[model samples]
Structures are given as C-alpha cells and as structure tokens.
Target: MASNRRAFLAATAVAALAAAPASAAPADPLETTARPRPTTARAALAELLAGNRRYATGGSRHPDEGLLHRHALAAGQHPFAVVIGCIDSRVPPELVFDQGLGDLICIRTAGQVLDEAVLASIQYGVQELHVPLVLVLGHERCGAVAATLDHLRTGAPVPGHLELLVDEIAPAALRTRHLPGDWAEHTMRANTVWVRDAIRADSAFAAATVTAARFDLDTGLISVLP
Candidate 1:
C-alpha cells in the first residue's frame, strides 16, 4: 500500500510539471499572431546563430517545446533549417542551438559522414520542406576525428562498418596532416568544410546555403570556419 502511494505521488508530480507553462511568449509560428517562418537563407542562419548565442550566454528561451506547440506540430512541420552534426551526446543541434520542435531538421552521424541516403534526406528537406540553411557542425576533440587520425598513424583496420567512417574521413585527415596548428583541429575543420563543399557541388539546392562550423565543447559556442 505504501509503495502504491509513492507511485501515485510520482505520477501526479510529473503531470504537474507538464502542465506548467514554459514561458509567456507565444509559441507557434503557424498561428497568425506568432512570428513568421524564415523564408531566406541569411535569415535562417541568423536565427540559428542567435539561438546559439542564447545557449552560450545562459539566456536560452527554450522556445516551442510546450504541449500546445507539440499539438501544433502534429498536423504539419515546416522547419527553417537543417543541421548535420556528430552523434555526440553533448552536441545535439536542437539543444545546443536552443531550438524546439519544428524549428530544425537534424541529421546526426558518427562523424557527420555522408552516404547516399544522407544526401537524399538533405536534398528532400531543401527541395520539399523549403528549408534554406544547411549547417554542417563539427566539434573539438571529436572521437571520430581522433580515430581517423589514429588510423593514419597506426594503419590498423577498424571494426565492422566503423572502417567506412575512417575511410571517408581519411582524405581530410591526410590533407591537413602537415598544417601548422593541431592536426586534430585541422582535420575536424577541414572535414566539415569538405562535407559542406561536397554537398554544394553535388546538390542543386538553389534555396539552400551550405555552411561549415565547429562547436566548442568547453564554451558551448559554435564558430563558423573560413
């Protein structure tokens, strides 16, 4: 009987937490009075960068994650941008960029490595969903980048399909191996730039503007690479 009561109390507490309001600002962009959807590439980039600023500065509004917003997204979704990032737990694009449901179309991989299916999904988002910005996010101290570098030094084969990732990233790792700064950082940035440029060259996404950026795990900031 005591255990039953404890479970009941826990359930009630969860319900109460869900019922609480997230913020005063209205959530849905589809609503007439709410903010309009981003239509241009530059505007989408600005919104994403601003969201990152909010996250890094401890001012994240946590927009569009409420119950009503979830309900609003059930009928349809029109996200403004697409983020291709690593599969690292700390670098979730939605949380790091401070966006909520329906704000971004995110695709995560072990090293942001590309396959035909990945390219197809991105093309579909730009052509069908009308998302204008495609940001490829690499990060500092990436294990994937490190692993690729290790393979370059040791020449040992990786296990399973992990070898595919090493193969894809090897070119960038090789290209930047002799550069001045940290080889890992150079490879990470170079890999991001290569992915962005590859997408631009292979895709005819007129509305989509591809960019490369690196996430700093320590500072929680994302810097665009030149």
Candidate 2:
C-alpha cells in the first residue's frame, strides 16, 4: 500500500510537468494572425462587413485610443475609407461601422447633400490620402429626407439654411412624387443614390477610383452600389 501511494504521487507530478509546456507555449501563428491586410476591393468590403457584424451583434471592438497607439498615429493617418452620411445623432459612422480610430474619414450633411465644399473635402481624401473606399450611408425614416419631402410636396417654408438643403435634395423627392406607396421611403433611398452619383459626377477621382467605392444604407448590410 505504501509503494502504491508513492507511485500515484510520482505520476501526478509527471503529469503536471507534461502539461506545463502545453500551457506555456505561445498560440499557433495562424490562430493569432496579425490584423488583416485589405488591399483589394473585395478584401476591404469583407472587412467592413465583419466589423459591422460586430457592431450589430454588440461585440464591438471600440476605438483603441491608448497612449501607445495614439503616439504611433500622431505622425499621420491612413484612413481606410470615407463615410458621407447624415447628421443624425444615432447614425454616427464609427459606431455603426465598429471602426477604431484612424479607420475612417467622415463628412456630415443635413441631407447628405453635396456642394462645392463637400466636393473639395472628398477630393482631398481621394487625391491626397488615397482612401480606398467611400460609403454614402443614409438611414431609414431620415428626418432630413422627411423635411425635404414636406417642403417639396406642400411648399412649406423651412427655416434658415434648411431651405438651401431642401433645394439640394428636392430633385429626388420630385422624381419619386408620383410613386404609389412608401414614396418617402423610396425617395430616401433615391436620395442616397443621388448623393452617390453626385460624388461620382463631381470629381475626376471618382472615375479613377471606379469599382473601389460603394454606397449603401442601414439595412443590416453594406450594399455596394459602385
């Protein structure tokens, strides 16, 4: 009985020693791969969707603004894309896309309307920073779209510079006026397409960056309407 007890203790010790290396060894290289490299359009789009899933599923990898990372990024930034979107509080581009700092260049307009200044900003992103993609994200039941529609359909006088915004967004609303049901919703989507086309039309960079950018809205997916 004494001999058997001693052997059991020795076996247990050996087992623990054997398990130590397994625990101490670093993870598999493939299992712990570095951040993905997105050079191509498909690769870029896939990454955006993957991040969006994390956003929608509440597993967001929030912006990493730690001291080390911030110091590293102080020199310059290489934002992956630019998002031209509405100014709605809930529709923040970073939160919706689950992107971290230095990930995106964002521009906000009341109705995502494009004019000279807006075009210049976009041109800088394209001509200078060489951002790989541009997303025009509009949302469901957008207040700006609703306001524009009201102004066009009823000739209501919207206050201040809002009148100019309405004028810019009026064409889409007018085009969809004769549609049967859900005209506002349809026009909202149309407005998104309009902005996308306006960007493409306004800049030579648009043609140069063809098949690299996309436009979509908050429909649970990043639809690429290039």
Per-prediction TM-score: 0.84, 0.76
Q: Which ranges of candidate 2 are over 4 A from the true structure?
A: 1-34, 207-222
Q: Candidate 1's residue-wise lDDT over 1-226, tens digit each?
A: 9999999999999898888887645655433335567888899888888899999999987887766668888999999999999999999999899888899999999889999888988988999998999999999999999999998899888989889899999999999888998999989888999999998887466668999899999999998888
lDDT of 2 by residue, 18-37 (tens): 88865586654433333554
When summed lDDT is taken over every stretch of 10 residues in candidate 1, the lowest stretch is 24-33
- Candidate 1's TM-score reads 0.84
Best by TM-score: 1
Name the runs in model 1 displaced over 4 angstroms.
1-33
**Minimal lDDT window, size 10, model 2:** 207-216
- Candidate 1's displacement at residue 152, Å, is 0.9
**Clashing pairs in model 1, backbone N/Cα/C closer than 3 A:** none
RMSD of 1: 6.8
| Model 2, CA-based lDDT | 0.71
> What TM-score would you give candidate 2 relative to the actual structure?
0.76
